[model samples]
Target: MIELKREGDVFVLRMDAGENRFHPDFLAAANEALTEVERAEGPKALVTTGAGKFYSNGLDLEWLGAHQEEFVPYLESVNALYARFLELPAPTVAAVNGHAFAGGAMLALAQDFAVMRTDRGYFCLPEVDLGMSFTPGMSALIQGRLTAPVAHEAMLTGRRYAAEQAREAGIVQRTADEAGVLPAAVELAASLAGKDGGTVRAIRVGLYKHVIAALRGPALPE
Candidate 1:
């Protein structure tokens, strides 16, 4: 349930929920999308949003709630998927058009930039309520993007907040009306695409190199 389209150098990726869940099949589709994105080569940019209103309702909470036995593997797969997104060598933007909850919010944060609609929907991460914690890898990114108090509240309260609030908190980069969000994201993309391709690639790759190194580092003895 991932849709990929190319509008010049801008690749538009949309997540479509299957059976109201992240279904393994959907992750397969995302894998292919990542493959094609890499194939495009050179300096490329991505604009990722979701179908319908929600940027993503996050991982199907109801589905997760119903299948408790699957929790460990589900988190394992999702964490792997998120790590892949973070390691991509290109600039990625989250054009949040609606709600982003839990995993959905984390997925958006995986992108290089997050631009959200000022209207409906919001962002939240409620794994704490589920008796777990943010994946260790995700914790650093959250701390880097959000101020101490804001990040603490989001992780602790599990409450959703609007786009403007997210921007103010530093989680979202830009905020615009529903109709303006995508355009604003495109505006940012256009600015990046207009610059020197090699310079842009260098900046993008250099920034993520540290994250990837961390991902690939030696594992602690179990």
Candidate 2:
């Protein structure tokens, strides 16, 4: 469910599955694509976006219902994915082409930069409305990525932010028309591709050291 494409020094990973929920196969494909990007030589950057109306809808509740026994482990893998993005050796951007809700929103936060579609889609955290609480790792990730005031409002109120609102809130750095989202993200990534990958990783790892720790530490509190 991941399509990898090359545009100059940037690698674009398109999530093709509908809604791009975090199912086992979907996660596997995403991680596998990441691995390829990590191992590639020379100058490179990464951009990820989804096909059609969903950047991602987050957790696959239906899959979780059927695979109850895998719940904790499944969340652990999800946390790991976030950590991987935080510490990726090259610059990374999220081209938020459509709705990014719950964990999907957090996935975008994990990226170094984000370009959202202005004409459509929303960036939201609906866990509170869904009667769900954030995992420890998730809480850490959100707090680390967002300013205190914005995080407070978003986590407590479950606000659905459109592109301009999200940009104002510092959730995303840029906004573009529906057709320009990915291109803007790719352009941004391409601009940063010349930086030394090793140094980029080191700097990001240093900046988000605690966030990465929480993400890699445990999915839930002890």
Query: What lDDT does the true structure give each of the candidates?
Result: 0.73, 0.93
lDDT by residue for model 2 (1-222), tens: 899988889999999889989999999998998999999999999999998989998998899999999988998899999999988999999999999999899999999999999999999999999998888888988999899999999999999999999999999999999999999999999999999999999999999898888888867788
Q: Which residue pairs overlap in candidate 1's backbone?
A: 58-104
Q: Clash totals for all models, in order?
A: 1, 0
Clashing pairs in 2: none
Count clashing pairs, candidate 1: 1
The lDDT of model 2 is 0.93
Global lDDT of model 1? 0.73
Off by over 4 Å in 1: 18-21, 61-70, 194-222
TM per model?
0.83, 0.98
